[model samples]
Target chain A: MNAIEFHSLSKFYGKHRGIEGIDFSVSKGEVFGFIGPNGAGKSTAIRTLLGLLHPSSGSASILGHDVVKEGVQARLKVGYLPSEVDFYPEMTSRELLEYHAGLYGIEKGEKRIEELAQYFELALDRPIDDLSYGNKKKCAIIQAVLHEPEVLILDEPTGGLDPFMQNRFFELLESLNKKGVTVFFSSHILSEIQRMCDRAAVIREGKITAIEDISSLLSKQMKKVRLVLKKETKLSLPDGFQNHHSTGSKHNFDYVGPTEVLIRWLAEQDLVDVVLTEPDLESIFMNYYQR
Target chain B: MSMNRTLYFKELKRNRKNTLIWTSIVVAFTFLILSIYPSFSQMGDQMTELMSSLPEEYARALGMDEGTWSSIIGFYSTYYGIYITLLMGIFTASTGATIVGKEERDGTAEFLLTRPMTRSTIVTTKFLALGTLLAVVYSTQTFFAVLGMNVFGDDVLWRHFVTMHVHGFVLVSFFTAAAVLFSSFLSPKLNYMGPVVGMIFGSFFLDAIAKATEQVSWLGYISPYHYLQLQAESGSLEVNWGSCIVLMILSLIMLKAGHARYLKRDIVG
Candidate 1:
């Protein structure tokens, strides 16, 4: 079953447009990455899916429950990390988690809170205001996952974290997905999405232009193969190899053929160091957004 | 019910500093005003002679014609009722404005709204938190006011204090509801000043119209401050139970409307 489904969802604030006709679905246990620029309706779409915002002219559902009509019920199975996580500054991490846990009727929430604290390497007793940005992000992450929610929706979850912490967060998300929890997250960082997301939807200007598997997306777009010749020798490349430019001893080719064809062509060339560069998610993301 | 209680307590915990500061100021102000009452009463004879020379309309405007000053109720009605009501209204407006709107200002609304709770629950919980704060402040002030008044050789009856406090309590709730209603509809940046200005100006206009013409006296019924008049008649100062009930119902209705709008409104990123 799809964990989330948006159908022609549109939202506008007075005369300004927010999102228009956003439609997508994340299947259960799938890591679906939502990619877009800052104002490409990414947050708006997530908010609408979470039932935090109402669509102006369409519908959304989670687990087959209508978001607008049965929001509370649908939200029960979901855990969310907002892009900007803000909580009561006076409360300690423990107190904040306990308060949230109380809403969900979690028993012995202190134990869960302690476990989360230990896992995230956060001090439960410290006030939220005193924590650093990365610690605060960890606190939010712990709170989001403590309930063991079936569906986790995170927006820019790793934005403030360092590279080490980002890797840890990805591991945590992977473990959660392994436990049959569906993960739906949005991020502008294409490389992170390429690594973490099984499938993704690229949105540009409030519209989803493409939704496809990560591997397929990279393969479909052209990859760059740069060959540095041992001796400046010219070789004839295949027909589809556009932009074959060379300077000094290095030859750059915008290779748009199969990996096997490129490998065979490189093997037939003179002694040289060849670098095969698969199209990164960043360039593909830019392709959608810039258009 | 549990969710509402949890959220209420959370709001209280979150707003402890602001609440404590406001409550302290209110208590200190009450003490200051009550301490100076004796000095004012010493000049009552001169003031009364001056009032007698003035026109009846002027005396009525100054609330001097209701010349029953022997009792605590009479003194409170003539001296501090209007002033306290205005103070309470301002406090109530500030509290209500911060309740729901503070979430937006602090960027916590998106996080809170994503929780597994209905928007009505959130609204009601915040409203309850504001009510709790008002009850605590008003009760504390009434306790101190009555104690202060008792030191002046007047028999401070429990019934009078209860009635006066009840009147203040209702108005606080009314103002809070009005502010929350506005907060839900307006931008967070304008939350504090907008509702306060509205309450002050709205009450002023309503009071002016009500006092200007007898035909429009019914308009007073629309103002929460009008129903909060605790010293209308001596020995017959009955609480307006009907209006009180109506005000409570209106507050709930307003809260419901806010919840409905917030639940449907798209949160701007």
Candidate 2:
């Protein structure tokens, strides 16, 4: 069974479309990424799937339990970390986690809470109101994983963490995923997706535009080519090359298509120096948006 | 009655301070009104003359009559309906409105709704908490009022006091449900005190005006206060079981409607 499924699920806030025809499923134990820019229905889709918002049409399920009809069962196996952390300000981190554990009927969460608190370097005694954004986020992270849920649904999970803390969080996620935990990671940051996702679905304006494998997506985009020819010679570029420019012995352009064809073409040129750079995920994400 | 104990307790603790403060106010007012009854009782016919001198419409609107200064229950009933019920209603009804809505207002709905519990469970647990808090305030004030009556009045009139309290409890419960219903339809960010006070005070005055004016007596039918009489006409006061049951039924309906609304609500960030 899929860890999570949204079969033609749609949500509308009256006439305003929140998410439309959002069809996708995450495989068990796979790290699946849901990527989009802000207001692109990423959070809307996440919220709907988590049963926070009712689906206007169709349905969603987690671990084969219907999110709307069998929401308690569906949510039982999943842990959700929201993009924004807003805990009860009166309670300390310890109290909030203990309360969360109580709701889940966890009888022995105090030890787990202490261990996670120690790991994250978060002060468990301080009120949530007094904690910094990063500290609060750490607290959120602790709660999300405290139950050791089978599925982790994270929306922009790394937002307020410093680089070192982010690194630790990613390591924790990696360990959890290795334990056969499925992760549905939603974020606007391309680099985070590139690092954590095996495959990613790109959302645009409340619809899924494309779902691409990380390696295949990287390999399929155009590469930036810069070369220093032996002399400035007039050259007829091939079909896959565009935006060619030359000055003295230097030539710069972009290449898309078969790497072997480019290699063969480059072999024919008298080159003194050559440089080929793969575009970052950010550029590729923008490329998808522009397309 | 199906409830999450964790959430129920958390909610009660959350409103504990507010409940304490409001309960204190009601308890203090209960004592003050009971304590001054002796002075009024000492005035004898002078008090009766004073009550008689007031305009008929004004006396009717305040639920005050010549019988008001005669006994502890009558005098206590006057202020109990106007001030005590309003005060307690403001606290419970306003608390009722904010209990679930506060999570939404503070952007914590995402966290709360995402829990393993269903929305129905959350609503049920929250309402249970509101009921518990209401009981704390209502019973505490009633206890102090009973104590005050014993200390201040010779006859005590326990039966009349019971009748007044029963009616007062029903009135406050009705308003509490109304607040929950209103919150489901209105924005969570609203300062519920204005609308809550308006609803409670509005009902009181609507019933009062209807009593004061013959042409608009129909208006009293719309107010819950009219059905649930806080003060009696003569020294003998009877608990209106029919009105109490009907208002309680309506309260349940409003509460059920609010619960249904919350179940389908899009808990936005």
Candidate 3:
């Protein structure tokens, strides 16, 4: 069964486009990634799915319940972590979690909250405002997952976490996914999406460019190569190269072929300088648009 | 519709400090205002003669329209009433405006909207909490007023005093509702307090202008202050009933509009 389904969902802030024609479904237990640059409508689509924003058109359902018409029911089995976490500043983290647990009717979730807190190394006694950004994020994650929700929708869920905490968070998500929790992860971090998602939907400028399995997505991946030649030279074009340009012996292009082929070709060029880097999601989307 | 009890208490707890502060302000101000009644009464005819000699507009501005300063009821209505209404209006307006909008302003709307509760429930819980806080503050105002009147003046007219406070509550309810309505459309960058203060003080100014000028007298109908002042002046149960109806209708309309706007709002931070 599909854990989540969005059918041509669109949201506009007055004349400003948020997300348009957003359609996809996350199968039960699937780790679905929503990859886009900032202001590319990934958060908009997720917020609409959570019923935080009403869609201008179309609909979304979670666990077979309509998010708009039956948001309460849809959210009963869903856990959401926003891109930026903020809580009642005066309340202690423990108080906030207890309050959330009460809302979810998880009477026995105290043990789970404690477990999650200990796992995240979060100090539950401190007020939310007193905690650092990473600590606040830990509190958010605990509240989201304490109910053992069937679906977890996270928007940029790991921004402030240290490397150790981030790895621990990933491990926790992995275990939860193993237990049949569907995950909808939204982030602009290409590598994080690549590492964690089974399938990813690429949104750019309020529209979905592609929705494909992670393996297929990897195949379409493009690396940006920047080289500064000692002098301007008429170089033979490489088959994998596109968007090739040279300015005063400085040349750049997106290479889609094997890394070795690009390296081999570059070795034969005039000696100067070269830099290889993974292109951001926007640049990749631009490449996809060109194709 | 399931009402989340946890959310209700959390909202009440969130507003606890604010409620205490407003309550204290009203209580302390009541003591300060009513304490002067003894000195005010000692002057008696001299004070009345001096007050009546002032220009009619200036006297009206001081809330001394055909009311003497010697009697506790007259003094209470003339001076204490204005301060009480203004303070309560500000407190209630600020409370109502911030109750829902603060979550969005602080970027906690995302945290709140994701919970297993409907938007209607969220609105109802917060609105009810605001109502509760207002009730607590008004009760303190009434308590302090009664205590002050008994200690500083002759036998307090308990019935009239209670009725006055009930009328004051209605006036504050209108301001609170208007504030909440304004908050629904306001940007987070624009603090709700500014608009609340503007609306409360603007209406008071309009109420004063209506009192001073014959041409814009109809403007009095638009101000909640006028409705409240009518109740204070009449001191009739029938007038109080009519005022209650008007205030209730106005408050309900604003609340309904705010609830609808809030339910449909796109919470982005």
Tell me which of candidates 2 and 3 scores higher on DockQ. Answer: 2
Error of 1 at B111 (Å): 1.9
- Specify the highest-lDDT model's number: 2
List where candidate 2 sits over 4 angstroms from the true fold.
A230-235, A243-249
- What are the per-residue Cα lDDT tens digits for candidate 3 across A175-229? 9999999999998776778778999888888988888887765555788889988
In candidate 1, clashing pairs total 0
Residue by residue across A1-291, what tens digits does model 1's lDDT show?
689998999988777787889888889999999999889888988888887777888998888888889998888889999888788787888888988898887877888788778877889889999999888899899889988899999999897888887888889899999999998989998888988999999888788898999988888877887889888877787865877899878899777667788778778887568887878888767766766
- Sorting all predicted structures by DockQ, with the top scorer first, yields 2, 1, 3
The backbone clash count of each candidate, in order, is 0, 0, 0
DockQ of each: 0.69, 0.87, 0.66
Candidate 1 lDDT for residue B49: 69
Reference-based lDDT, residue A173, model 2: 96
lDDT scores for all predictions?
Answer: 0.77, 0.91, 0.83
Docking class of 2: high
Candidate 3: tens digits of C-alpha lDDT, residues B1-269: 34668888888887888788988988998888789889988887888788779898866654564445656766786655567787888988988888888888888888888888889999988898888888889887887888889898896556666666777778888999988998888875577777788888888888888887778889988887776652233333223678789788989999999989988788766
Q: Candidate 1 residues B11-55, lDDT tens each?
A: 888777776777777767777766766765677777556646776
Local accuracy of candidate 2 as per-residue lDDT tens digits, A4-111: 998999989989988999898999999999998889999999998898888899899999999999998988899898899999999999999999999899999999
Clashing pairs in 1: none
